[model samples]
Target: MTKHTGAWSGTVAKKSRAAFDGSNLYRRLAVRLDDGTTIDVEVGRALWRELEVGDRLVQDEGGTPHRGQSSTA
Candidate 1:
């Protein structure tokens, strides 16, 4: 299995939806990292509900971090 270690912080740029097997809806987000890199991060329904465009995100191997709250200085 692949392990996602540490964490990556970014902002939610957009949301996407896809239907798999004809009826299963999948949600993903386009995150623009602080380094100017963009990546697609797949998320579950619970986390999806908490996320919105422009919201800051931090994710680790365990999954969504800080319950989707934006990081603080």
Candidate 2:
């Protein structure tokens, strides 16, 4: 068996919608990980506002990291 380890972080590059009735919209959260790999987090439009550029997110062999705010200082 093969185990899937989802590890990456980028930033939000773009966002879009379909009909405007809040039906088929996607919030693409781009992440630039420490390894230099970019990961795109395709979530709902309602949740895109919570993320921004330079926001750090980490995930290792354990599990997904908490979707909380990051510190720069």
Query: Who wins the TM-score comparison?
Result: 1
Worst 10 residues of 2 by lDDT: 9-18
Question: What's the C-alpha lDDT at position 61 in model 1?
Answer: 63
Candidate 1: stretches off by over 4 Å: 1-6, 61-73
How many residue pairs of model 1 clash at the backbone?
0
Candidate 2 global TM-score: 0.50
**Model 2: per-residue lDDT, tens digit, 1-73?**
1232665443434443345566755445555655666555555544556555655555555465435445446
The 0-to-1 C-alpha lDDT of every candidate, in the order given, reads 0.76, 0.51
Alpha carbon lDDT at 48, candidate 1 = 78
RMSD of each: 3.1, 5.4
Highest-scoring model, lDDT: 1
> Can you give the TM-score per candidate against the true fold?
0.73, 0.50
Clashing pairs in 1: none
